[model samples]
Target chain A: MHRQFSLQPFSRHYSHSTHPFLDFLDFDGSEPTSAGEPSAAAHIVVRPAERAQLLDVLAAYKDAQNAGTLLTLTFVTVNDYLWLLRAVSQELSQLGRSCLYYLAAAVSDFFLPRQRMSEHKIQSGKGSLHIEMDQVPKILKPLVAEWTREGYIVSFKLETDEALLVPKARQALARYGHQVVIGNDLHRRKFEVVFVSPKASAPRADQGESVPGEHYEESWLRIDLEQHPQKEIEEDIVSELVKRHQAWIAAASAASA
Target chain B: MHRQFSLQPFSRHYSHSTHPFLDFLDFDGSEPTSAGEPSAAAHIVVRPAERAQLLDVLAAYKDAQNAGTLLTLTFVTVNDYLWLLRAVSQELSQLGRSCLYYLAAAVSDFFLPRQRMSEHKIQSGKGSLHIEMDQVPKILKPLVAEWTREGYIVSFKLETDEALLVPKARQALARYGHQVVIGNDLHRRKFEVVFVSPKASAPRADQGESVPGEHYEESWLRIDLEQHPQKEIEEDIVSELVKRHQAWIAAASAASA
Candidate 1:
């Protein structure tokens, strides 16, 4: 069944406090000297007021540039993000089975349709403001079936309620026919995540023999903060995904042979 | 008549692209070497992923720290900004006529009340989402009457429609009994601003003799970008406000004597 969806574009004034990527970097409050100095080398401090400058700095960083480790692009609205994602995915699809799509960013679930939006600022004289937004269309279906069918797709499901994680992840996999869904509870996300995927022996949904809960498998990955105070949970998650992708590639090659 | 107001707190993920402050800074696409090097000294570059680090860098900047020019604070929600504004104004009130409040930030007009918020993410299974928000309270009333009665208060009115600028600004001054309301159209904000204030010889609103259009005056400030490309409109705005503030302080001193 085809579904009609709506999305509202939300924008905010830039303030450094809400930056998402910088949240991962650890910094000491001490001052650093010149760029080549030992103190400066130990800590990298940047104060980009907007995204363009931030991307520019990241693109120019000596370590990242030498390693060819970072590539950056920015989008303003929901539609901008969607278009960029589709274009990038299509380009990556050229790699076929080697490409692994790691979908992480939390795209807004709802948006205000352009037709309903006011041209001027909504004035406060109206006592109260009522806004009816439409649901942002689910794009995972197209990403899996059309954009990159041979690529291994791993999507993320973050939930405030812990109980919803596994079920939501499973539902996403079934609905989109994606390879895996990494489910994480909001509070416990830093320390734990569960990977939900179709079980190796289970019948595929396309075969019309698949059962709901019985056809899926859940593998939990966790880290001990006490033992490894400095370790990131992403390290473990990425390592596991790398192994899975390798196996998938090997199986595809063997089946073709 | 007592008016009810509603405010919604809107938040966004940090993407350098939407930063408001950085929009003012000029950057050429060039790399910098060491801090003491002439090339590095010529241009300042910062890549702050979030607000905290950005503030930290600003606080630590040598020029600002030595000049005692910059003080920064960040607020996450509308309520937080309101509370902070109130507390700061109350403290500044002690300065009496010497204090000047330059109210600029484009505060959100509508906000969802805590009681109406959903605990979990709004599922997209529902076809559309409907939200009714309350108009944010007009804090200027209390700010002028109570927070700092003797202080010079300058509020701002920004409108997409040019015709509404003067009327809206005049209405604000009459309603709040403040000293000035700087009105500017969104498109021409950077190039021009209209300072709307009560006429010097007009009867005060407190005297109950004030008329709407007759009692008020407007002084337009404009900067020709082609003639003076390097000049900022704020330079003129501040210089004018400083002169007026000196006159206000002198008048109060003479009256008290």
Candidate 2:
């Protein structure tokens, strides 16, 4: 008998006036302003710290998902983003498909708190973190297993706390049955990346044949879905879901033993 | 001087995709249910042609103006329910201490296309009209006069017919000195409304009270302005604008004047 990951759904309801702490925004991908002026708030919000932020991001993502966006979900707070990663994984598992997706939580942990954040000058202490990271739900593991059980495919993210990214990715494949796991150095706003898949052991494979990830239109997706009438956007989301499911089913069955 | 309504000042771009149509949906608000039937949708959609059913009622009370709503404006369209009037005049004009609370149009003549409309059980003849009814822009006259030239406030809705609402509204009041004209009706879903203003109105004395007119929610006014972020079922449009502009206006000036 195969074991599985069980996920419980949670929603954070904010009061009329208060906002969740975890709702702070991220400066990454944001255009910085000229010196000696207030920072421009173009995609620049504080990282979210409370439960409400998670719900807000979830609501935004849900609205987008329902509206047919294939974009990866983005958030400000490291903790909430991590939590969301697990949530998405658990949701996928509950639907009888395991997720093999990457979540770089330790990434945000490196950033200093907002009160201590200074853009111009780097913080001095050059201190190393002796972090006591608690156990996060390894949603990716169970998700990938669930997908395998139902004959599906999935992928995830990884950042090196270990010696080699390739070995780490292979270990993940052996344990969770993920076809691929993207590994990285966990730095901010950089373009360098690495992809690790079960097929990585085969060099003669169609390694260069991988297509680039498609990017989403920021301004278009940046809308407050609640502000627009329901039809056009809603129909778009439905069409995207159907398309993805059909493609995923085809790809997984053909590749599976 | 043989003058017309003052032209509205051009301003920054505005996006007003009022979600009220979606939010107030009873898609199946009422469950015309049968045994073992599925739940009716919580949304309601009415089409452009069907709006004639609602307009028939509003035209009945056109002359009776002072509905005495405690609220300031009338966010009403023709045949709007008695509860949602927004005394639009109250926001732009006043005689020192009195508010000319009335409504103007930023309303839609054509509504969302409908699927099924109710059959008319009228005890009348070809009471049906192939109505090419151009929705008259409500309150275009007075709102444009005082607010536009001196401190204008008026509104209008334009079609490919651009709007005759403002000019017609101004002529109705025997003055064109309004500051703003809300122009909109078709060709755009949101942000189509423009605030147009015309010159001042000549002062009148010995004003007499007019009989009461029925009122309702100005879905049309809310369409371009309040429809953004979404439409609230309980909010009155006139009072909302007053809070934004500090005018001590009447509840319905034209009816009582």
Candidate 3:
């Protein structure tokens, strides 16, 4: 997301008050000073324990870079996002690799036509502003069916009210015929999410019977971090996804064999 | 505005990778440290020049606190805001103090009826979700006329399109019968604004003439930040506002005299 949306690197504007830590780590990206000294590095003070932890992080970052593990791609506008999907579709076809589409962008539901948009800034002389916008095309259906049919798709449904959360998520899952719909409330999105799957409610899954449904059985990967305040929900979500992907790969290999 | 509407302070969630600053600042609002150290002093570090600048800030902060020059009332919800305005109204009547209302909050245009809102979190089981919201009452109109009457009201007009900016600002100014309407486009809000006043276009104040009709007496407050890349636009904006406020105060005094 930073690759496409942000003008400056996220780290650059992390915080004015917090730059001392970055400077202490020798990762401050500020330009060279007139004195030719590392920008305020001599002034950075930290405890031995803190220094050691930062060093560990720097080492891990360098290791990841050396291992060619990072992919840098950014899209700034809606058009850029559309173009990125097309590019990814072509690349995935060439590589013959199944992908996981984790959709988490805050997409606008409606938009004004680009051509009709004023070239210059809008003047405030008009009495009350009334905008006419057309609903944006729901692209997830085409993406699921045409672009990445073999891939697993996890879509997020974030609603302001708790009442809308589950229903909208189920609707998304049913509409797109996707693998998972993670429902989250806008107020508590960071800590709680309900993973909805179509096959989870099937009675025979508990009996270890093959359910007559989609190739992959539906299930909800429910993780609540409310009790464990220190734990990150993403850690559990990522681990569960990795396991699911491995299982899918192993099952496909067994079927072919 | 987080003091009014946000669940958490913005700085708390600022860094995705580093929570060290929050830890150091003890702004994580977690348990007290064993050492009982003052978080601000210990965590702060700066270069020689920056240290001098910080000293100046500290001096000013101390002066303000010593002089009892700060009002630290905090509101955390919509109801809180409403109550605060009511309290202020009563206080203003007793004190008979004029005000400069600078409204900068991102207020929601619509809200679900409180009585109809779901008591529990919305469940994801329902197929599709539909939401019906009602327009929020236009509180600013009453605020301008009844609550903060005899005060100079400066309202902000933010628009996405550049072309609609000036027109919308003028419209707001005319509709509200306010002193100043500061117009900004979302795309370039940080650096530029068009300050629209009904008096600006009025036949030259220098000429001591009165002009009829309001076409547009707009003044653009543009900070060409290219030269001084590190300069904040707020610094310029605040300085300009100070002059305008001084002028307003002087005019009020002279008119009474």
Candidate 4:
């Protein structure tokens, strides 16, 4: 039996002696090792050594199988990969079951990098790993497109290329078939943006074209999926996908019907 | 040519773009029905479709060859899978290069029930996939251990049996020889924890006692990395690992000396 838990700030967590989380990042590299391998990098570090210790801790916890004792900490890069005109999509994306990839955490397309990691240390004799950098791709693009391709019916993010914002976003859906292309302004924040379905259209609401057009704007809003943990965002996304998929299904069905 | 775009929501992402990510999670079922094919589970549905797209985008961006545009996004997760962890260590195991695997993004340890996928609409009238999740070895443990096993120092994470208040945070260094441990409380809205290192018995900075002592009462103060991203909480995390690594190097140098 395996249990999952995360340590939150202002929180108290426990580990068993026989649990699975048997290791911590060791700042000290005193552990034994074979020759020819390189030394660990300085940027990413964990502490402690005996992974088996943590593993034993987790193993025991799993045996006990207590959900209350099970907690988790997930991370996300905020605003650094803002390639959109709004932020709502990000809120939604962040709301679902998420994990973060730190190594790939992209710097914002037009943002600043203060070298915060080594700002002070750079001047010290300790040495530094500084280098000039350039803007990387908006991180959301890969996630959005990949999720869509997996038939997860997740959302694709679009930071409107000011020159080709709508066109590019719309094409993403057209090309990737993203369930909803969340288009946001590069400058806007706090979840303001248009949620676009892949067909270059918006989800139809019987409210009779609230704006005389199918695409209705839902201003920046936060999606609290975790607050209502019992509620399934996965299904919500799936239901939405199925609804949108019906059109494709219908067109496909009709063509053969 | 290899662009690391976000995986679009499952269904919509695939609606239009044939060029879009197909199945970030497709790594599964399709792994191999081939004769003697290795096994796979198509669950981690993040960027399956964009795997190739990522290559394309990366190629374009790396060479500055793309005339149209380039998009990038990054996601990270931690696991103890030996092979995967080893791969991570292999990928970013550079000298003075710290590999930070931010624990963000969602890739569950489950796959949807195939019946749910096949008879989804017919059985429920609403097509839905029931994901059966199980625990897999973490993605980070293996790498850190491998780094150590390979003679390279590496850091790791410990999602404790308890996340909030960890008594083990302090002793982590001495027990495991960790340079530092970034204690994270999962419940905290943002990452909140202490960068714990083995303070020397004499209370030397970064090399003091392994377990968090009374001095840490003041250590739990509110400090934001953004405001001051410099003061490496895990400041010695890298250094500690490096020291051991350097020691080995020094040992080698002495032999050469």
Candidate 4 TM-score over all chains jointly:
0.26
Number of the candidate with higher DockQ, 1 or 3: 1
Residue A181 displacement (Å), model 4: 22
lDDT of 1 by residue, B1-257 (tens): 00111121121222334343333232334644553112442343344334344444433444454576645556666787788889989998999999998887777888888999999877777788888998888889889888888889988999999999998888888788889898999999889999999988766666432456988999999999889986879889989999988998998889889
TM-score of each: 0.77, 0.24, 0.58, 0.26
Per-residue lDDT of model 4, residues B24-51, tens digit only: 2122344543542223321222243344
- Candidate 4 or 3, higher lDDT: 3
User: Distance (Å) between predicted and true CA of A154, model 4?
Assistant: 20
User: Could you give the CAPRI-style class of model 4?
Assistant: incorrect
Interface RMSD of 3: 10.4
Q: Candidates' lDDT values, in order?
A: 0.72, 0.35, 0.57, 0.37
**DockQ of all predictions against the true structure, Cα-based:** 0.33, 0.01, 0.09, 0.02
Better model by lDDT: candidate 2 vs candidate 4: 4
Best by lDDT: 1
What is the per-residue lDDT of model 2 for residues B1-257, given as tens digits with 9 covering 90 to 100? 00111111110010011111111111234564463232333222333433332223222222122243222122233434112222333433344333332333333333212232323211112222221233333333433434322332434434444444334333333333333334454554253343333222323211211211111012234354554555431244445455534532332344468
Error of 4 at B220 (Å): 4.9
Q: Candidate 4, which segments miss by more than 4 Å at Cα?
A: A1-257, B1-85, B91-132, B139-141, B147-165, B168-178, B186-191, B198-221, B224-257
Top DockQ model = 1
Cα lDDT of model 4 overall?
0.37
Report how far off residue B1 is in candidate 3 (Å): 3.9
Please report how far candidate 4 places residue B162 from its true position, in Å. Answer: 7.8
Model 2: DockQ against the native? 0.01
Q: Give the per-prediction TM-score of chain B.
A: 0.75, 0.28, 0.72, 0.35
> In model 1, where do residues sit more than 4 Å from their true spots?
A1-60, A67-69, A207-210, B1-60, B66-69, B206-210
